[model samples]
Target: MKKLIAIIPLLALCACWYSFTLKPYPDIDTVFVDSFANETDRFELPSAITEGLIGELHSGSILKLATRERAHSVLSGTVTHFGSEAYTYTAGEEPLDFRVTVRARVRFERAGADSPFWDYTVEGFATYPMDESTKSESQAIDEAVSMLISRIMDRLRTG
Candidate 1:
């Protein structure tokens, strides 16, 4: 009986710290994700990143997707880098694997605000075998983009 009574208080305390939903931005409920500007040679990155972000926003309840005219905040970014380099080499110095990396400069701001609430850079990478039959560069790029989306989501959640 004593242990049960003690657990009751502890359970109540734990419940107080629990949240049913995420409120990423307490003051903003809807957001407009702008088409990312591509600065890298990879011309597809802008649309890919933008589409990935939209899919993420749709999957999560943290924020509602809105048009710029109706949005309370804006999320914008620029794809600054995209490249691949040898990650693993054979005994003879032949490339066995490569790492594809993507980087973006992102900002989150309130609608009509002169300054953003947060602005920073996020990067993601993925490795693939050199053999195109097993895994292709396109697959690695997709993985890197997924990782990038996850990092962006993390930033939004924490900020």
Candidate 2:
């Protein structure tokens, strides 16, 4: 009974030592994400990234999705580069795996602001086997897109 009482106080103390709140963008409660501009030859990248971001925002509790007219902030980006290269090769020089990379220039700004508060370049990549036994090129691209979205989310939450 005495040990339990002691642990109770210790647990309460530990709980008080840590607290979490998602107020990363304190000034902005709602955000509008725009369709990313595709500078790469891949025509589907912009829409894919844009839709992925919207889906993330819609599912997350940190930021509410809003229409452009009702948003406190706007997020836009340009898909600057997309490419796939050989990642691994067998002893006979046969391709074993490939790495797909995607890069974007992202901007986050207050609504109607003249300049963005956050402007940065973000990159994401994923590797896939040549055999498609595990993952295919399209799946690798989707994984890369998820990685890119995760980085963007980290930036929003941290900055």
TM-score of each: 0.85, 0.83
* Residue 35 of model 1, lDDT score: 98
Q: How many clashes show up in model 2? A: 0
What are the per-model numbers of colliding residue pairs? 0, 0
Which tens-of-lDDT digit does each residue in 17-81 have in candidate 1?
55644565688999999999999999998899999999999997588899999999999999999
Clashes of 1: 0
**Every candidate's CA RMSD:** 4.4, 5.8
Which residue pairs in model 2 clash with each other?
A: none
Q: In angstroms, how far off is 60's CA in candidate 1?
A: 2.9
Residue range 1-159, candidate 2, lDDT tens digits: 999998999898877754454576677899999999989999988898899889888986587999999999999999999999999999999999999999999999999999888999999899999988999999999899899989998898777
